[model samples]
Target: MSKGVIVGIDIGSTKICAVAGIMDEVGKVKILDIVEEPTQRGRVSNGTVVNLEFTAKDIDRILNVLSDKAEINIHNVIVNISGENVEGKAHQSFLTRDDSRSTIRKEEIERLAVDIRKSFRPTAGNIIIHTFPQEFIVDRAHVPDNPIGRFGITLGGNFFLISTPNDPHLALRRTIESVGVKVQNNHRFVPLKIVHTLFTPLADAMAVLSEIDKKLGVAVVNIGGDTTEIAIFQESGLRHISVIPFAGKSITNDLVKAFQILPDHAEKLKLIMGAIPPDEVGKNDIIKIPGVEGLPDKEIVAQNVSIIIEERVKEIASMVMAEIMHSGYDGQLISGVVLTGGTSNIAMIKEVFTKVTNGMNIRVGNTIRNIGQTAVAKIADPKYATVVGLVLSGFMPLDERVPEEVIWGDIPESQVSIGSYNNGFDTPNSKLNGKKEEPPQEEEQSGGGIFGWFKKKVSSAGKIDMGDDKNYTN
Candidate 1:
């Protein structure tokens, strides 16, 4: 492990949460400590930084507590960027080669990525957050995967580029740097700031998704105070992302408008009453609200509250479903939807999503392989997933590759099962009825292909051990 400790700060409209975590010797993520602070009214709208000064102060307070608990100097944090200003669009780039016989190198592909950024600015003042590769085209033909070592005349790449307005991008950096968190790259001569800014939907995917889930396809629906973030992943890549303005705050506002109550009171009712489908609650059950200035208390039916909550929840769910379908990956999501954020915890909120999305496999988000099952409170809450992702950022890049079928495929039955005992044979499937073994053919009788005369040879003899470097073979 190059680095032991990582800190992630999740800056949301409702609150700011910081998490300090370390990858232990056994390779499990261990949460060191955590600290949280409210964003204060009007400082942040949704996930955007409206007031840089106060946002910096809120982050500073949280950093102070986390730094003390972790006993480490707090600088260089993994943070996220979000809000309506952020958007993603398709981008393509071509690296033309004069001679088709020239072999492509890794450096050339990296150069292509660097050169591609210059073309992403559709409008002025837009900064690219990420350039996710959708596919690589070699000589106008599809290659199996990343074609760094191939020979081709034209290398074209299809990408999904995420970008934000310069104002928000600069504001986010300024807020973090104001609180003493500066991102620096000393190993490389060129200064790089791209490594520090992770888009929110990608962070949500990192915290809750697994390799199979992403490879098979999955969607992350993050329901927050002021916005709902939806991201679709297919073939181990982020295919789409959408931010909806309707969220928990909308439900609170509806309650305030219908009952003529205070915003705080409405928020309280939404949280305590629980947002469930209207039919789940009985109509006769009523919760009395104490009126202000010694006025008469008002009686409110539980079913009415359910009705208001369910309506807004359904609208958000409908938009979420629409974004997934619009991505054109609706049928490919075998892992289905994984829900996160504070609003996702509402009672039976998933019930509404299931019904709206036509019964996809929707479940509340949890760390798939990012963290082990633990007693830490933050580990269990979906609200802290973004911060946890920030902490996990040090271990792996956003682009996680699925294993190729050719290199690692299914194995045959072992010795106990009377088929393939080891990798001594070259058959994809070696099956024999009962315990009898099949005799070798005429070609196998000759000492050819390194396996002399049907004799078995051990191609690999090693066990997987993370701590021992010699255990691995090339």
Candidate 2:
């Protein structure tokens, strides 16, 4: 209520990242901390908490570590949920009256969205995570980005429904609740949507498709650890989205298969070899790889490594390009392709992308603004986009823009009052909600690292004490 510090959690397969920041009176968000913890299995299949208990424990550990470092609470943080199954489809719905000439009001349009979502409810125990209103059409005329007040006989809207399996949803909810923290939101949105929101200046599906040179329609390719998300934009709105089930991990896996090495060694070799041309690598160039259990150490040809990686990268890029071409954009993404995510960090990836895509416009994406110069020099390292976007997304207050009165989905008919949970708010704690407390002495001492000076200033308030008194479990 007092413009509290905001936190963003991006739970990915490879790692769970937590970024916390506070906005000053002037409205600039200063990132306080960024922390990552490797998942026990290194990735969550299809974004579900397959191993719910293990995943929850890992999340708790990361939250504890970050809370200490940032000296902030993660209990009420804004988290982003993304995965292959999470999808967005544009649906057009309208309020039609048997008799024409009935003037439409803002409430009518609000109800229109609610009605649309209600129509698509799953018969099973699944949940719609997010309902995004894309644009409004009033009669024959187009309305503003979010049309609510315009008067018209018929109101139409383009909405996106994001859903997930009910079990995973329950697990995510129960896990966070178990840690004494409420799930602020489960934005069943995708990584690309977050990227578009955080970095509006870049080539968003709508921006590239509608605003950019027609010849250069853009393919926003986001390469993550286990999956690569490809979205095609032509003439401004999203045309298509496809998820390839291979990415950095695939390349890492390829190295293992070809060299008969362990994943760790293969991953290191993949990152070090970078993306190079198969032909450029000489056959005699050998690299030593550690021996596997019961096997002698091996010597592999660098050419073989290059050939293997190039083949995989080319195949993946081709799949993405095929998605773009299938979208039937007016021309090739003359603007070329804008890449982002961890896989984009592979050295010479841009070159490989160009070769694979027949030389379209290609470059890596970043949050050029928001991040400080010093942090930019360090954090601008592309792989941090989603985590950075998670932090930045908190700064944009979506609820403030929408009316507070309209309900977006069907209300459950539970015997107990669920009003407190209706509007994305938490219920006040009572004895029934027994809470736990963490020790104050475990809070990270601030003055020893990059943020040492900040720790000194905040702690110097002489009001600083061990944060063990907080209502959270260890």
Candidate 3:
């Protein structure tokens, strides 16, 4: 329970994980402990909170368990968030340097970089998360890196920008605030400060990808329960990113619809019994599944189930293939695809990807480099890559938008009212209250959710009652 210890909370579609650890002297993230709890399905879908109250409860439950295991009142933490709303696009930013300046001064280069960030105006209700300059052009020539001290009249940067809507971003912080770390001294609560907010795909890249693969051009496709994030990297930097709706959930739902089984059973059938290519399954095999209530046991052909799984897996891969092609790094990715997340553990998934991407040397990334706690080598497994990456922030902090320091957001670790207007969010803080807009739900996928987190009190007994969502309604 040292002051330097920072916790990482990863809220995903199917589960919530809280990890407490500190970087060891050897520059490795030492795992102190980890605690996980079910996300109760769609409470948090595609990494965005839908029912703020229920999501808060789930997060609070996990953190409380972590606080007890670590034997301390954990406070500040780094967070990873995602959603289908997360999108990235290639953009051009240019500046015409004046002749009077003579030389390209440091500030001039810096000004040009900031100006490009300003130029990217997302649609209303959206904000830029991070802007990465892929190449610096000086006088129509590409400047591999620093453009300073170089002589040029036209200074420009070709960038790939990442952005998401403000509503979900706000909802994430408010959800954290509502579940703020509980105090033990008295029956009171304080805002659980967020030290940093990161993109899930970026964090997964940090844990699952190596520098060599990056330089050789690699794609990270994290297939989680409700979403699959695609990140294409080359020259040791991000070139494009996207979040798609087809993922493990889509496959599970397909099984549910085709097999007439519950979600849990369908998921097990997918994981334990499913495989690529119907030929991998026996033609005459019969699998029996227990029926709900008092009905007779259901019988299904094994090859037919495998065929269904393979078809859905193909669907997910097709979408992923389209994204890689869209990135324009399609042919250049020598390292090919590095798949992460729970669904990546599927049998023969590599062959599926290899077939889809025309044999791109696909590999499943399951281990983290220089990771401590070797006894449980893959300490966190692929599912917790985001949180594990956060734990390694001491040494592997995310790269700044540019060489110069420009802090877009700095939310200090201080107590505040989650409900009242005095909350400490750097942005104008408020509960999206009466205007709980529900984003379009694709099939069963709703990218948007409710937000009514308040400065609810938690008793000294370590219990909180946030009450009903009706109280905050319009």
Candidate 4:
């Protein structure tokens, strides 16, 4: 495949975001442009395309804006899809070797994956979007991280399958195509293919998680406008994924009803004053809101705002904790939970999570630290996590990737082979000969003083450095 720019488009419930970037020789992502526009009501819901015409127009507008800003004609994009309709299931497939003593080969593994894919049968109105291998079991006795050269008569392992309802899937595809851009085609075993639909939480995990985090077990919670997505990883693989139907929108609705305020005003108030308990908000502080129509203005105590937000946040946190427990990896996640997405920016969110999880460690996940560029402040918001992760997904090496073979429209399984996996493992030139290649090492810069630590923190926070210039805040 030719190397060039990669674009990641996040069609979210609240907004649509597009990120354009290029992966450098050293595998660093350099931002070219970022654009976002609100998703008008009824256009999209819970990450699924509901109105093709409206969505297509919005997608076209963002793509055109992004193209103009980046000075390139964007044709394809890696999109993220999420919602309650999107589901995940766990399954294990076994393959017996012809020779009991023969060692497992790369082709054998590839064939096993293909067989597993072919065996899956989605519901009548659904199609599989992604299939991920969690681990490899050899002879039902030994579990090897990589079973390429392991000798075993029987080979089997756990796999996680993600599927979405067909109606939304087809609607999303038609919306993209309606804009006159060809969706990137998926090829068997191709590396870093650009055109695919990714699970939103999975994409968010890829963008914020480190190698250690994945190996030690971690849960990523992406709280979006209308839904909250959860992805669990352990041993460098996906273990569990789920979408909570309630999220930031739920909190906004709660605020709207609690304060008897307009929906728009409630959203604005939530963003401005939302916080968990012990957030240092003064009880006597009052916030005035313009009344609807000709009604008199209302004065609400800041403490009341915190109280309303705290209750909703606690409920959400409890739900997340319940999901973690249900995943059966509750105590196994040494890396704890990484909260991300737009709602993660809420004040004292980490505290709420910690309280709900019985003092489990929690950290806010952001992509700013992973990006290698100076002017990335615009995309530093956690709201851009999925899109940033989608861009980063295009830069991952083949072996470390998963198949993003989206079943387009209602196309027959024969048209797009059921076993057509594009994770780069089936390529003829693949070097999966029982040897792992070391990733390219980056040169380190030395800095350890107090000032250096402060500088590093500032950089991680996506702040621009201007020597001798006064800092400003928005």
In order, candidate lDDTs are 0.68, 0.55, 0.69, 0.71
Model 3: lDDT of residue 244: 76
- Ranked candidates (lDDT, high to low): 4, 3, 1, 2
TM-scores for the candidates: 0.77, 0.71, 0.79, 0.80
Whole-model lDDT, candidate 4?
A: 0.71
lDDT of 1 by residue, 212-320 (tens): 8888889988888888888887876667777777678888999999998888888889987764545668879887888988888888988888888888888888878
Candidate 3 structure, TM-score to reference: 0.79
- For residues 156-198, write the lDDT of model 4, one tens digit per residue: 7666767777566756665575565322332211122336678
lDDT of predicted model 2: 0.55
Candidate 1 residue-pair clash tally:
0
Error of model 4, residue 337, in angstroms: 0.8
Which structure is stronger by lDDT: 3 or 4?
A: 4
Which is superior by TM-score, 3 or 4?
Answer: 4
- The weakest ten consecutive residues by lDDT in model 3 span 451-460
Instruction: Encode model 2's per-residue lDDT on 206-309: one tens digit a residue.
Output: 11223453223567777777777776544333445555566778888878877778888997898767655455667699988878677888888887787777
**Cα-lDDT of candidate 3:** 0.69
Clashing pairs in 4: 189-422
Which digits, one per residue and each the tens of the lDDT, describe model 3 over residues 1-474?
A: 224677888888877888887667876667777888877865886668788888788778788788777766777787886897776666666777877357776666556545555555454566666656666777778765656678877877666666678877877787786676766953667778876567787778777777788778998888898888888888766787877776888888888999899999888788776544455678898888899999888898888787777777777887788777766778999899988888887786788888988888898875556366532445547777777776655345454335413223222122122223222112434344454435543342323311110111111112212112212212
What is the model-wide C-alpha lDDT for candidate 1?
A: 0.68
Comparing candidate 2 with candidate 3, which one achieves the higher lDDT? 3
